[model samples]
Target: MENGVKKQDQLTPPPVPRVAVVLFVLKGKSVLLGRRRSSVGDSTFALPGGHLEFGESFEECAARELKEETGLDIGKREYLTVTNNVFVEAPKPSHYVTIFLRGVLVDPDQVPQNLEPEKCYGWDWYDWDDLPNPLFWPLEKMVRSGFSPFPTE
Candidate 1:
């Protein structure tokens, strides 16, 4: 207690960091990305992925989120890396453990569709070396860490 003010024990505990599975769906030297339309990373360039559901594996999340957001079916996805993302600049602060994966599409000719317009603007392939400005926290952190989703030739 300071002065005449007394602070009680806070009932709400800190939130645990959530696991978000993000994917790198590539075609040649380009990767798939979409502008987010929801809270947290709203309006920022993000990959087609979402939070990891309970009882779901990382691969399952990679497949589900991709199909749900972009209507693109992935054949198989392998783990690439993980990022510790804490959105301190967000309007509402959040912490997330971002899992990265490299996904191969089931059909190479199947173009991506915006299935969830409420969550994303649209899907487009962007050159990895020349991405758009204002990337999502996790992606931006990965870029700053000198990480490349692509395999070295």
Candidate 2:
């Protein structure tokens, strides 16, 4: 009881689930990924993505996040699959349904830059068979499920 009034913790509402949009920019046999440096999955390699904004479509979120995180524009987006990520070991102990999308770079010669230096350590291309160590949970789940972002030439 506080301020002469009774309090009940059970009355508190549960937190809402979150959604994230992840895009795999494919160019031939390589895919773009960044080394995460944030609290959620620090030191893990992850695709370019961000929290889904309210009232935004998956395609829109993918494009926005790609530009915001990599400074590269996407041409056409292909809907991939969604992964339900429950990060029990996360610093915030959060859950997310990550929508995956794949697309090619609009400009073949364009290079990815470290747009968000505080969150990521720039972007680099990695082959499917040889990815960096300690991948983010969602990406690891996708990989372990035999989900190939690049299935064709």
Candidate 3:
């Protein structure tokens, strides 16, 4: 105890690395994306996702986020590659260890709806060959790394 105070170990530890679980709901030759309107990655296209909750698995986080953000429920959560994203140029610098997830919609007719207008502008399907510009940094990284959610028939 220096200066009449306890050692640093007496204090609480820092938070863990931020983890974002994203779901890629694949359709025929296209995947779903939402136009973001939030502070971190505003005006860019992003997949449905959110921060991983404590004591939750990746698949549970993905399914929960999808339902909360887009009002679409998905099953058969398949683990995909993860990306380490650091956004240094944003108004608020941030980092995320993004866990990618793939799932087909349980109902083919169940399309995405904008459940959180405050965070998302809208949702749409984008073909991999023609993705929207200014993609979310993690997604851009994923594309640049030659990752695809589509399965070869």
Name the top lDDT candidate.
2
State the C-alpha lDDT per candidate: 0.87, 0.89, 0.87
State the lDDT of candidate 2 residue by residue for 1-153, as single tens digits: 777655664566555679999999998788999999988889899999999999999999999999999899999998988878787787777889889999999998899999999999879999879888899878987889888988555
**2 or 3, greater by TM-score:** 2
lDDT tens per residue, model 3, 36-136? 99788789999999999999999999999999988888979989788887777878667789999899888978978898999999999999899999998
Per candidate, the number of residue pairs that clash is 0, 0, 0
For model 3, what is the alpha-carbon lDDT of residue 35? 90
Residue pairs with colliding backbones in model 2 are: none
Model 1 C-alpha lDDT per residue in residues 50-135, reported as the tens digit of each score: 89999999999999999888888999798998878777777777888989999879999999999998888888999989999789
Estimate the TM-score of every prediction: 0.88, 0.89, 0.86
Question: Residue 103 in candidate 3 has what lDDT?
Answer: 92
| Model 3: lowest-lDDT 10 consecutive positions | 8-17
lDDT of 2 at 33: 92
- Model 2 score (lDDT): 0.89
